[model samples]
Target: MIGTEFIAQSPETKPFWEAAGAGRFVLPRCRQCNRTHWYPRGICPHCLSTTIDWQDSPGEGEIYSFAINRMGKEPYVVAYVALTEGPIMLTNVIDADPGALSIGTSVKVTFKPAVTQAPVPLFVVR
Candidate 1:
């Protein structure tokens, strides 16, 4: 994660990462539009409203898609977890047999530290 250093998150998202560092999965919800989104932004993507709130995710999801990255700098699993709340997040999948991966396997969020000590949320089969 050197050159790929974590993008400095917006102030709107700082608390999300802080809570993640503390091992909680928080997501943004726009009450006005009644939709949930990730990577916390100042405005709601659905309705373009400033009305947003954060809630703890159940941390449960199913793999919407994935790839066994065998030829990259280091072999890894990259996947889109379709969060139970409706947002799909791109994150790493850890601690599972890549060969056994499937499109709809259940997963739960886990935290791993980035270079800056902010925890990056990943997932593992549950």
Candidate 2:
């Protein structure tokens, strides 16, 4: 989580951050399209419906893709994790060697507190 940043929650994203603060992972599921998506919002992107609700996810997924940035003082991993719920989220992988991670690596959601007081969602090898 070398560069994970948490920001002040807006109305559309408050519950998400609150749930994360409480150690729960939630995603917006579109009631109309019955699909989940990354980057929470007031309206469902898939169906363009306002009938969106929060659903608690198991928060486990496989690495869809990744890259290691070794130029930083300490190398860190940047990755796209394909969640079991069907959305691919951009996140960082922690607590493992960069050389040990690759496509299809299993990972689980983890939260880290930021100066903004909101929890940043990250991942770790599962």
Candidate 3:
């Protein structure tokens, strides 16, 4: 199983982790550029502005790309999910048949406990 060590929980990403712990999905939006970004940062990557703010995400997205990891202790699908709000996130897709996954398949966020700390977000087919 994946662990919290795989995730970087720093001041810059605290809000994201906090929201995930509460079963909510959030993304940072640049107030200046009006764009949403992943891998939360202090400044907008696009505009380099310090006006980023946390916003609740609808948690609905489509698979932008995917690959199955059959060599691991357990098989799992890793994917880039394109959120409805326009940001793409690299995440794991769980609780579904790997063969049934395809590009453009709709998915929604779900939270599961991490090995050492708060819950982390995963995606499920919807």
**TM value for model 3:** 0.92
Candidates in order, TM-scores: namely 0.89, 0.92, 0.92
Q: Please give, for residues 1-126, the per-residue lDDT of candidate 3 as tens digits.
A: 342225688888888888888888889999999899987899999999999899999899999999899998879888888999988888889998999999999999888787776788888999
* Residue 24 Cα positional deviation in candidate 2, in Å, after optimal superposition: 0.5
Q: List the residue pairs that clash in candidate 3.
A: none
Q: Positional deviation of 68 in candidate 2, in angstroms?
A: 0.5
Residue clash pairs of candidate 1: none
Q: Which stretches of candidate 1 lie over 4 Å from their true place?
A: 1-7, 72-74
Compute the lDDT of residue 64 as modeled in candidate 2.
Answer: 97
Overlapping backbone residue pairs in candidate 1 total: 0
lDDT of 2 at 3: 32
lDDT of candidates 1 onward, in order: 0.82, 0.86, 0.86
Ordered from best to worst TM-score, the candidate numbers read 3, 2, 1
TM value for model 2: 0.92
